[model samples]
Target chain A: MNIHAIKAIYRFEMARTGRTLFQSIVSPVISTSLYFVVFGAAIGSRIAEVDGVSYGAFIVPGLIMLSLLTQSVSNASFGIYFPRFTGTIYEVLSAPVSYLEIVIAYVGAAATKAIIVGLIILATAALFVPLEIQHPGWMLLFLLLTAVTFSLLGFIIGIWADNFEKLQFVPMLIITPLAFLGGSFYSISMLPPFWQKVTLFNPVVYLISGFRWSFYGQADVGVGVSLAMTLLFLGLCLAVIWWIFRTGYRLKS
Target chain B: MAPILSISDLSKTYDTGFQALKTVSLEIEKGEIFALLGPNGAGKTTLISIVCGIVNASSGTVTVDGNDIVRDYRAARSLIGLVPQELTTDAFESVWATVSFSRGLFGKPKAPEIVEKVLRDLSLWDKKDSKLVTLSGGMKRRVLIAKALAHEPRVLFLDEPTAGVDVELRRDMWRVIRELRDTGVTIILTTHYIEEAEEMADRVGVINKGEIVLVEEKAELMRKLGRKQLALHLAVPLAAVPDGLSAHNLELSDDGEELIYTYDTTGERTGITTLLQDLNATGIRFRDLQTRQSSLEEIFVNLVRTPS
Candidate 1:
């Protein structure tokens, strides 16, 4: 299993987060806090409630999901991509570690970082609004599943991207917008009937809806469907990763 | 004893349609310093990359200490270490951390003493805590070597270890390499610097156009392919080489003050005595004479210049 190798890589990646504390931990915490202040305080003042929950508290889970999704993708992708960019990937390729171990180390570390950020954002949200968790176990499970799935997707993007601009392409242009439109700031039901259907198509919606359901027990979609959708996406990411390693796509030549 | 590393009929045709290696086969003995000498783009890096598990071969097999590189990669790769040509390192990583990380990457248990010894051997102990980007180029090169050695592999491949370093660092690196060889580590280095091979290689392999053209003991290869030249300084100037000395195939200096005689080193007879006798009899008097042997550089140039 090369457990030592996996530990080494995981520790190395986690250490990088420590080194870039401001960017990795502090920046996300501050930005999500702003989302709370502006959206939860300024905007929630106008709307009394959504789904029988205070508007300010209603957005907490969604806001946390937004950060978790983006952070997971960026962390995992950049972790792998920087090594490729700097040519340090040669050492990793030549080492005794297996491809599965490499993926576990990188994806595991990315997910860990994203979960930490998610928890910190949740704590920050508590400072702005009264938070509740009807199903704490479900909430944790959703956080874990969503972080791991997005981190795996991020790992694929890291391998697929050949340049810096492409590295930013997914997180900035695709994920952030998806999270915004996937019910981060408001419920998907608040959207018109047509746009609500369209919002369901965004994968981020399933993740956020599942997470929000765990928090308030009031979800736009059935909890079981959201859980199934998250698992389905996780399986898809795993399949793509398996194919990538098997074919040596964008990794070996 | 069986060879520490063995490669057979290895070939690689990249997706770009460039054949980097063509049916290459070679064996490196344990604890010997073997040098793979070749020009740029001669597949030196590709061969190393394949054996180290960085690149996959299109065909053939490589075994490290009898472990097949493909089927038993973990064991095989654990037995080998590679210091790649490029100076690729994490700019933010401290020297100590990176070296330790490499050791762990090879599935070795944490051994601070071993890492310390490697760092000290490479003269990197003082900069152990410094970030990689803060180190000089030469120091970074040393760190790469340290990283490769951190796992204590049986075989080490150094790809152009001293390409752009200054003379002092080159010599220092050579000394470190020798020290490693003395510790019974099999070293296979790829270089175009003929002198590096001449100075350190126990055996030399010449690869050209994706094939190994020759592999011989350093001293034996020199004796077999090396040529000798004898230059005679004439006491008096002459207009041309005398017709009588034509049998010796002598070449006269442009100013006609010297004569040169070339002969194969491996031949039973150098013909030098006969040439001297012929010179005296022909009244070609000389003030002084000197003999020079062809270096590995000349032999290497000649080897690669010709179609194998």
Candidate 2:
């Protein structure tokens, strides 16, 4: 709660990101541009529009969500893992900082990076896809909410992870692929009816659809339902994070 | 004055079924240097961890200045600081930033002057701007100490503060520790080096096998447990111990070059005079004789070797 503690946490975490700042910010923008070049030019030229929005524009929200989710998770996970790896966690844990203060600081710093990367990807997509914002405020809302939600989830992952390998295992093998298959590049409607229903089971579909709803004012799922799913995921991630901090799971024992 | 930290019937058992601490009770008085001595895996770190609220105890309680460590952790933790055995600091951060940030963890208002003084005390002020990874191993240790002292806690625990430092840094660290003690801070240090505790501790506690074997004043523990060895260099090497000199516990060197007699110093008679008379009666003459008293290291080994 104290500014000094928050600043210290932010500074320490931001210092970690600062090491790869150029990568965190630039890589997403570049990747997004590449996607626009390949997917927008190659795929959009053949397919006019998926849901009354141009194919290039339709994929924008999902791409931004992909970048935001992965970057947020990676940033927060590494932010916390490095301390344990370098053995600096002992100093932090032994200090007078409470569990809540530590969690908020690291998660908040990670959310900051994820938000920046999301914005940059958005801007890059604008250059190629004629991106328009049906509801700019809602777009920001989903962006901030998803960033914070994933950041908290990443915090828990970092604590549970024992080493570097484990840190990447969950995000890379599980979360990223799930997000990609959950309709980041294509609309779930393009799939067969069976696959379309199956896509509904992928939690990431709700995040992307919710974000897309804010952008093009059209979604495979209801916007309110998408928002509900994001809030649900946020609550679930927060609960897990709170439990880790309270139990002193990997951080203490 | 009252003790700043009180641990009563504290115990910890890890999930691996290792009982690190058992029914350990001790009081660390304010403004005193208390040393915890033990062999590897004797739970010195566990005890410190429990007091600092880093590791929880399975049972019992630790109170720092009347605040229970678990129930009132915020207050208890705020009053104490711990320097871990590992020299773990933010490698990419400057020494000043790391130390100042540690101060902030306790929600302390910014006091750059206090931070500078602490760094200066630990000889880390010059390297304040240097990144931690750029410093040598000894400098990293000093930064850890500086961070621990940044908040100016009433109690400080150094868990093997000088495990692998060079001689110069070790001495300098002790000097700084002594200075901190002089300033009325309670310091509890755990070290593998017995000489550190021997030289600096006012009271020493020996822990072994999850139990506190003994806790006594340094001088008192030495007086009660220390022994002396009278090593006699014979003019002629003896082939075997004579029957007449067999009454005393005398050990002949493997090469038959010397005879050694171990005696308890606390006893009324050391039996030196009688042993010399017996040696002479047995027609044994020693060209030289020397006596050496047991050091804290020997006493510590003996103390832990005994059943707790």
Candidate 3:
């Protein structure tokens, strides 16, 4: 409801991201570029094609998703964790802003940053391998949804964590591994049948599959299912956040 | 005029079963400076935290200008600006940006001129472009005050605003606090420095062990604190105070079982030795005596006891 307050918090967070461009934007961009080089160039050269697309191009969407997920989590988690770490959250807590507006500002800024990083990485990938968007609209949709969704997850992680170590814990321990196992480097179909079924249980598989579908008209699962799973995760994070503000969990008291 | 902030039967019990606040009740009038005085672990912060909505109360309620702190939190909170005891700031942001952003957080429209005015008011305008992390501790404290004032609320709560600052900064902070009060903002501050309360407050509340032991006009609190009570156990149960001892400031107990002496603890002499000699001469003997400094009776004694 307080649009001005949201904008204030939003611009401030975005400014912080700008001040630490190296840590916030550049580091992730560079790391994803490394993934493109090692996995796309060296590894893809050994394999001629998968699903009728060059291996280098095949991993493009997946690699972008990897950085998107991690960057969203890190940007959002640190955005909030730093305030809690420094004890500046009392300002926002005592202000006229509502819990919903606070979430909108923080999560919105983080998602925007992650999406920007995703777009820049997409640009960098174009330098290495030829790329195409079979469905440009869907590509943007997948990118926006994933950024917003993961940023929400990151917001939850931030509120849940009290220490810097814990802030980094979820992104490092849980999300990174999930993305690696979720077909960010290879299609899940390439796995053995039993392994493929086990990999299906990983929620991130839907995101990458739907995203890759938007890229090259290929996917390990239906696009609808991917969209559904993403929305489901988004809803779950929203519910948890609502409960957090209601109970004042980790934030109010 | 109605009270600006009213708290009734507020209490807080930590998960560890430590009762930090027990049924605290207080009313802060509009435009008056009120001071809350208590020692460590005395629930001073707890009470402030609850009223600011940082710490949820386990019982009772708080209302700011008739808006319930819990039921109508936005209305209640929008009226309050808090300078927390801890020195916390946006470390990477410029002083002006942080203060302006705090104003926006209170849903106020952006006014760069007002932001500049707040910065200048705190003498932070020169450092407006400086990153917060680069500023000294005193400067950072000033930024925190600026941020709290950026909202320009009807009431201001300063929790230990000068706890660790130097004397000069403390004086500057007092000036700022008084200026805020002069503008018709109700001010409530907590401090270990009795002199600050003595110098600034119109009303003073003393909290101890999670309870408000006394709340009165500053003058009354100071007046009550001017003396100590020494109870003398008597060897003989006299029918009345010895006529000879009437001039020595002594009162015989109802049954003459003890002699109660009231004396200014701050006087050049307590006159105890002379009183004892007079008692000996008056044929009045005492078996035992004890000096007590209860909350209401010895507030000044404790004030003078503080190392300043």
The best candidate by DockQ is 1
lDDT of 1 by residue, A18-118 (tens): 99999999999999888877888888889878989998999899889999999999999999999999999999999998889999999999999999999
Across B5-119, the per-residue lDDT of candidate 1 in tens digits comes to 9999999999999999999999999999999999999999999999998898999999999999989999999999899899999999999999999999999999999999999
Off by over 4 Å in 1: none
For residues A1-253, write the lDDT of model 3, one tens digit per residue: 8888899999999998888899887887788778878878888789879899998998889889999999999989888888888899888887777888999999999999999999999999999999999999999999999999999999999999988899889999999999999998788888999999999889999999999999999899999999999999999999999999999988865
Docking class of 1: high
Task: Give candidate 3's iRMS in Å, 1 decimal.
Answer: 1.0
Give the candidates in order of DockQ, highest first. 1, 3, 2
- DockQ score of candidate 1? 0.92
lDDT of 2 by residue, A123-193 (tens): 77778878788898989999999999999988888888998899999899988998899889888988999
Residue B155 lDDT, candidate 3, scale 0-100: 92
Backbone clashes (count) for model 1: 0
TM-score list, all predictions: 0.99, 0.92, 0.88
Candidates, DockQ: 0.92, 0.59, 0.75
List candidate 2 stretches off by more than 4 Å.
Answer: B229-264, B268-291
lDDT of 2 by residue, B152-202 (tens): 898999999998999988999999999999998999999999999998999
**Descending-TM-score candidate ranking:** 1, 2, 3
